[model samples]
Target: MPNHTLVNNIDHKDTKIITERSAAYGDDIWFTQTFPAEYRSVQAYYPIFFTKDENTGRFFSVALFGFQQNENLFIKDNRWSVPYIPLTHARTPFLIGEQALMEDGIEKHQRVLFLDEDHPRVNTEQGEPLFLEFGANAPYLESMADMMEVLHHGIEDHNAFIDMLVELELLESFTLDVELNDRSQHQMLGFYTINEDKLAALSSEVIAKLHQNGHLQPIYMTLASQSNVTRLIQLKNAQLGL
Candidate 1:
């Protein structure tokens, strides 16, 4: 239930948003939506995986932060411990949306900036201002627009990439069973990952096709990112005082 509205300087002239990384601002997320374009950075610090939306049955890429629900090991003392926060996580309270516009007696849809009025980060004072004295966008606001642009295109590209993986029979459901330092057992389910066996078994022709389509590098990056799972385990253990 996001209270999204097309951004306008007049309607939101005094709006200021906190840009700090803190759990109070809702940064304690277990995972954030991710895409192939961000795999290189995201994979370096977090394990990349996929989950299917129960309502839509659509697949989404994600960067993992913790092993279980509602747990984010990265948040310690209300500060994010990681350097490379995913764009999707950083771009809170703002999103790209479409609006109908009329031009020359014809109607068309145009992309517009939307902000969540109900987000905790949004406030009227003591943060980055959305506009200047004369209705000009603030510097930080401009940066947010750039980030939103990248995210908008990245989401489109990622949807196609996921489709390609599914078409090639490269996606498989995986279950992770973990034993904590205290000998506590945990099991993670309902997530998907690329099948390395299927990927390696592909013919040269198919590999060439994947390469031509700009999907080959990200595929390898996702595979290499599995190594980061051990890092996640270490973080969890540290959080547990092990």
Candidate 2:
């Protein structure tokens, strides 16, 4: 469970967040949520795939880091090897929360910053400080807030993009079977990818609409990212000494 609390300078002036990438800090994730705006940078380093939420049955995009659970191939020597870290992963130990406030006799909802008090990265003695001596947000905290803002809107865009893809019947289920150099086999299931056949068959008018909506490029980027699976397999083989 997460001990979530609203961040206030008075109560958390000495709080610090460890920004290092390491499994000890809970960075050993196999995949993380991503959005179309990040597809260009993400496609270069990881394979982009769509995954469905079990309870809601809604699809969302993810960038795969490894073949199995808790196996993040990007973490080496306590560092994330990729140049571009997904926003969801970059904003760690911090989350955006909505607070209802009354402004001029009107009730309004505002996004507020919340931190996980029990997270390993949270401490009072080390890493980036959350607040300065005068009780103002530190530079690191500002950056995290900005990241959270982007993530908040990006998720909305991601959902809309997925809905468009679904309406167009452009997503297809896929299963990947991999045989490592040492003959070790791994199978990936319950993932979806862009259906190139369906996309190619779409009318030019539909393609124009996708282009106008700024989603066409990301669609191609997702397809191009499939090549990274081979790179991922090589990384896995290297790990196995195969």
Best by lDDT: 2
The best candidate in terms of TM-score:
2
TM-score of each: 0.95, 0.97
How do the residues 50-116 of candidate 1 rate in per-residue lDDT, one tens digit apiece? 8998899988889999888778888876567878888898888899988898999999998788999
**Candidate 2 residue lDDT tens string, 75-108:** 8888888799998888889999999999999999
RMSD to true structure for each model, in Å: 1.4, 0.9
Worst 10 residues of 1 by lDDT: 73-82
Model 2: per-residue Cα lDDT at residue 135: 91
After TM-score superposition, the amount by which residue 168's alpha carbon in candidate 2 deviates from its true location, in angstroms, is 0.5
The C-alpha local distance difference test score for the whole of candidate 1 amounts to 0.89
Q: List the candidate 2 regions with Cα displacement exceeding 4 Å.
A: none
Q: Model 1: runs farther than 4 Å from truth?
A: none
Instruction: Quantify all predictions' global Cα lDDT against the true fold.
Output: 0.89, 0.93
